[model samples]
Target: MVDRTPCASTTAFAQMAGLDSKTPHPTSIVVHRQSRVLEIEFDQGSAFRLPFELLRVYSPSAEVRGHGPGQEVLQIGKRGVDIVALEPVGNYAVQPRFSDGHATGLYSWDYLYWLGVNQETLWNDYLKRLEAAGASRE
Candidate 1:
């Protein structure tokens, strides 16, 4: 069974995240360079803090994920990647540029929530893949 979330369950933010269909959209999104964390908050009190490395590795770019089946590339050498810029893409998404010259992914509200929801499992899987491929986070 899929674990349905609360914050993204019945708000506009959730809807944007492709989550739910209620009011109270996202209120704020902040990026912290020193801590390498991106913080997002919804009007319904839903908030998440995402790491730069995770964001970089999980970027929603065709270059990283590819446009077909089994085309996902494993990103490496991004342990210290930071969000250098957060350019707004109209009113729906934000384009975050990484310090390592990665600036193609556009993160939507729903996408951010999805990442936060599955972060633990995704991070663990990334670690496993890194170990198997002998890739370093450095």
Candidate 2:
């Protein structure tokens, strides 16, 4: 059998050194509302851009995701909304305060990177769902 147990000493050393073997961190973020895109720049100079509408709809706030799972508040009229501010949430993520004063949610680095990578398909699907529900971004 293979040795699957983690070396405690090594793990402790890595943790103490802040060397997380799990994920990479983001260096910067830029949101372009006019282009409907949110860009995330990594420490390696790699970057990706996601759509504004997708980010708005997927906002991680009680205003968007109510108290429980089924109590989600559907966001509307956020098509061309811009990111007014990007507040740092410790060293892990950023709270993108929108022009609409939606500064409640904290978007993690991993989540932001995922959003950028999957923006196109997710945004298209969101638009379709909106149309089906007779909702307009206007």
Candidate 3:
């Protein structure tokens, strides 16, 4: 029988050992304006293509997420938001400058992973919120 467990050298294995530095990091980042998507490939060989509108609405900045609980600003009318620039913030995060002049969000690696994992569910929730608030994303 073949053993399916990952080897010690694998990024997942390192994460299991509590070595934060050994976590999967992005190997490539591609921003495609034509598709309005940001593609990120990790060291684990997994890739996530995130939309610019989604990224803008879910920005990790205080202006979007707020400084405390129950303070999140509902992002609407961002269906056409664009990513103007992607700036590396050290080795831990990236600051995406949006066409709307928003540039404070610092999207960390962990946060990106979370976004990739929960994107669909979060998107549905956002849509529901917008609909309930009579907001139109035009």
Model 3: per-residue lDDT, tens digit, 83-133?
A: 989999777778999999999998888778778879899889889989999
* Rank by TM-score (best first): 3, 1, 2
| Residue lDDT tens for model 2, 33-67 | 57867777877566887666677788867788798
Candidate maximizing TM-score = 3
Worst 10 residues of 1 by lDDT: 16-25
Residue 123 of model 2, lDDT score: 80
Model 1 scores a TM of: 0.82
Q: How high a TM-score does candidate 3 get? A: 0.83
TM-score of each: 0.82, 0.73, 0.83
Quote the lDDT for 71 in model 3. Answer: 96
Kindly indicate the candidate among 2 and 3 with the higher lDDT: 3
Candidate 3's C-alpha runs over 4 A off are 1-19
- Which candidate, 1 or 2, has the higher lDDT? 1
Every candidate's CA RMSD? 8.0, 6.9, 8.6
Please give, for residues 36-89, the per-residue lDDT of candidate 1 as tens digits: 999888877888888999999999889889987899999999999999999987
Question: Using lDDT as the measure, what is the rank order of every candidate, best first?
Answer: 3, 1, 2
